[model samples]
Target: MAAAPGLAPDAPLHIVSNAGSGSKDAHEARQQIEAILTAAHRPHEFILIDNPGELARVAKQAAEAAVRSDGAVVVAGGDGTINAVVQAVLPTERPFGIIPQGTFNYSSRAHGIPLDTREAANALLTARPKPVQVGMVNDRAFLVNASLGLYPELLQDREAYKRQYGRRRTVAMWAGLKTLLREHRQLIVEVEHEQGSETLFTPSIFVGNNALQLEQVGLEEAEDVKRHRLAAVIVEPVSTTELVWLGIRGMLGRLGDDERIRDFPFRSMTVRLLSSGKKRTIKVAVDGEIFWCEQPLTFHVAEHPLSLLTPTTVK
Candidate 1:
């Protein structure tokens, strides 16, 4: 197997595998990845991590090792795991790769990384390094998207529901519906962007770094990811019936036609909560991980682009 451009064939590859990812058999996934690397005659080291808290520490160590040896780090897990590793790898400017084993591999898919474990591993041999822009919320980096209001609430409830029941689409949908019906309070926020400043009364706000995912949800597709901009979709304040209708449209992939759903592009923005005496901190879901960040929250493109190894066919 040929190595990617600028990457030496003899250079070692460091792999961090999350054993608790959405994959049915993490052990099998790790074995398959190792087999592919071995067959290619690549020097590699693999580590399996089950706890999320330890991911940052392990990945940081791997990244440091990679820097000294001029190697790369491969993360085999879901978006959340990838996001965690990204936080550590971005600062080091090390070459990064991913094997999508998540329930929603939005980040990987957006970058054209193969979802199949074997295919993804094979692609790595010939993939090329590309600089992809990343989105930042406060101090953290998110590869896919982040949101507030009803969406965040829904995500929180979905995890609780999943814990009681099981990880299922039906359960997630039910949780979202329940959250929407129960949490009817609207948020009044002041949004300041490159365009201008505007006050909005909304129930939800979605900020996306991946245009393909946004397009799938009926928002306009971004012409370029390297533009270092975010695509935002804000749900305008509406009656519960209208909100339900908007949800139906989103589910049916017709949200683009819904007037209540506003879409725009921004290089940077500030979202300030107008509710008096509201908590200084609020929950923001970044790549499916919940984080409580101090408001007024700021969103912007990162200063440096991620050095990603993607399939040659992706470009």
Candidate 2:
């Protein structure tokens, strides 16, 4: 087999460490990355980020450094970190890489980036930069998925519970149940897409870009992603108990068949909050990171694709 045309053996790698997470896992990832590249005699440097709040700024700096050094921009962390770095790297048109330290690792796994630390680092040596589609929400990159309403609320609620109860799997499950049992206000919106338009009253709007994540949830719309389109899912307004049951069904990977849920595929969409009253922005969870985005959130495939350093086996 012909060898993949990758970066020069001595090309610099500007690695952003802990830009998304400050957990011990990130620190260990840093250590492993350093060890692998050092053994291979590769040129690299780590932009160690001690403060998670500086993720966006640090990511920009890392990307700029890679551009100046004529190297690749690499990130070590979960979806959040990758999302941050992706936003920076996209404009530079630089080779982007990731070491999957995140739990789900949807984006990395989707592109054949290994989950194992050493293997992921070693693969970076020979992987070629491949143009990959990316989804953008209000001009911000979301490598995996973007969500609004109950999903972000559930994540916030779970974080609160983790502080009070514990961080065990059981605690997390209980927290999700507790969050679902409560009443959630529906989002009344005017959704416009390629298929046409409609007004929807739902607890959450989930737009998926990664096929692997969509498949894991048993949603057939995963196929939509392969066509360079985004997949959307919304649950009809329902009672709290019924909503809780729907959440359970989702966890069981059987939620797609339920009548309460509706999903479709589209190239682009404009969502206007018709019932938001005076609110100018809403909390949106993009690639597992939460932030407030202005009204009329637009979701679509980015005009330009990301140059991802993907393993040749994947191509």
TM-score of each: 0.91, 0.92
At residue 31, give the lDDT of candidate 2: 83
How far in Å is the alpha carbon of 191 misplaced in model 2? 0.7
**Residue pairs in clash, model 1:** none
Each prediction's RMSD over C-alphas, in Å, is: 3.2, 3.0
Q: Pick the candidate with the highest lDDT.
A: 2
Q: Which runs of model 1 end up more than 4 angstroms from their true locations?
A: 1-5, 20-24, 164-171, 224-226, 276-278
**For model 2, what is the alpha-carbon lDDT of residue 189?**
89
lDDT computed for candidate 2: 0.85
lDDT of 1 by residue, 154-246 (tens): 888988998899776688777777776664788889999988999999988989998777767677646544466888889988887787777
- Best candidate, TM-score-wise? 2
lDDT, candidate 2, 1-315, per-residue tens: 112234665789998887344567666777888999999898999987768778879889998998898899998777877998899888888888888876568889999999999899999887788877889999888878899988898878877887798555577677889999988898898999988999999999999999987887789998889888999998899999998898788778887898999999988999988888999998899987898999889999988888888887887
Candidate 1 overall lDDT versus native: 0.83
